[model samples]
Target: DVGCGYEAARQMRRRGRIAPQHWPHVVAASRRLGIAGVSYEWLAGRAAMQRAAVMQGEAA
Candidate 1:
């Protein structure tokens, strides 16, 4: 569940997204889970691509 939550946050951070007020919660969770080597930029790019795909699907 921690991984899923973190991925969700990463996706949400794409496309000029703002940091959530509860960001501390995510940090705490990641620290607790000992998650390492996370790359925000990569996640953002991936999320942007996913968002584009969804948008294209809707348009189609």
Candidate 2:
């Protein structure tokens, strides 16, 4: 699922890790799969802090 991949990417980014550079591929895949409301920029913007909060079980 695109949503799952996106979340995994976000988590990878959060841990100061390097995920494969697959944004464009993911975007295309999402579009083909009819996954709507997927904004890469927005996801990237919030990823680090969001992941931190989620990992810690609290608001960032």
Candidate 3:
């Protein structure tokens, strides 16, 4: 899900990426999704766990 990156992901306006104005909400959304934290490694680990859970659900 793009969430707030829909426009950027689609390359709307030729930016092909998120604009500066969207940073705050993007970071907020990332935090809410458990993908952002005090440590980059922590975030990666959490994301891996979440991804595995999602894939497991799909397999089920």
Candidate 4:
């Protein structure tokens, strides 16, 4: 059965046997936690959205 590749990547990293391909998935894995990610533009967009939301809240 298929398993969690990101979890595998994490274990591999802990064991010092990670591969380059595992990086993006691993990085994206904890993105919401802001631990890491592969999307620079996505992060920027999220920041912009949050900023706008805060500004709107202030204007309310």
Candidate 5:
């Protein structure tokens, strides 16, 4: 769950050109999960989530 969350955050950070507060949460989760690196493919898919959130006027 954290890997997916981190990837989503990473994508959002890139698209918005702003670091999110949750980044620290993501990092902490990554350490706990022991993932080597976040998956780019997973991160890329976050664009869809971002778009959907925006359309719904909700946080991504």
Candidate 6:
């Protein structure tokens, strides 16, 4: 599906084909790679946990 959409856009370049327009695909790929969906709250919590672990000097 990605390739198909890319090819279709490529074929319509003269009509302003949008490159890198497959954001959903990119997000899916990122999620599949064990990437964290981080937010400010999540990051703060994670940092706190890590800091606590480091302060204790044990495996987090």
Q: For model 3, how many clashes? A: 0
Query: lDDT (0-100) at residue 28 of candidate 3?
Result: 68
* Candidate 4 TM-score, true structure as reference: 0.39
Best of the candidates, TM-score: 2
Off by over 4 Å in 6: 1-37, 58-60
Please give, for residues 1-60, the per-residue lDDT of candidate 1 as tens digits: 233466666776664442444444545666677876434554466558778988999999
Residue-level lDDT of model 4, residues 1-60, one tens digit each, is 113566875786585543445445545665645764446455456557767888999999
RMSD of each: 7.5, 7.1, 9.8, 12.6, 9.8, 15.1
Candidate 6 residue 23 Cα shift, in angstroms, is 20
Model 3 has an lDDT value of: 0.58
Per-residue lDDT of 19 in model 3: 46
CA lDDT of every candidate:
0.58, 0.63, 0.58, 0.57, 0.58, 0.53
Ten-residue region with minimum lDDT total, candidate 2:
16-25
Clash pairs (backbone) in predicted model 5: none
Ranking by TM-score: 2, 1, 3, 4, 6, 5
**TM-score of every candidate relative to the true structure:** 0.40, 0.42, 0.39, 0.39, 0.31, 0.33
lDDT of 3 at 20: 46
Give the per-residue Cα lDDT of candidate 5 at 6.
62
Clash pairs, model 6 backbone: none
Model 5 lDDT tens row, 1-60: 433566776886677722444445555676688966644444445646766778889643
Off by over 4 Å in 4: 1-37
**Candidate 3 has which clashing residue pairs, if any?**
none
Q: Backbone clash tally for model 6?
A: 0
* Residue 56, candidate 4: alpha-carbon lDDT: 100
lDDT of 4: 0.57
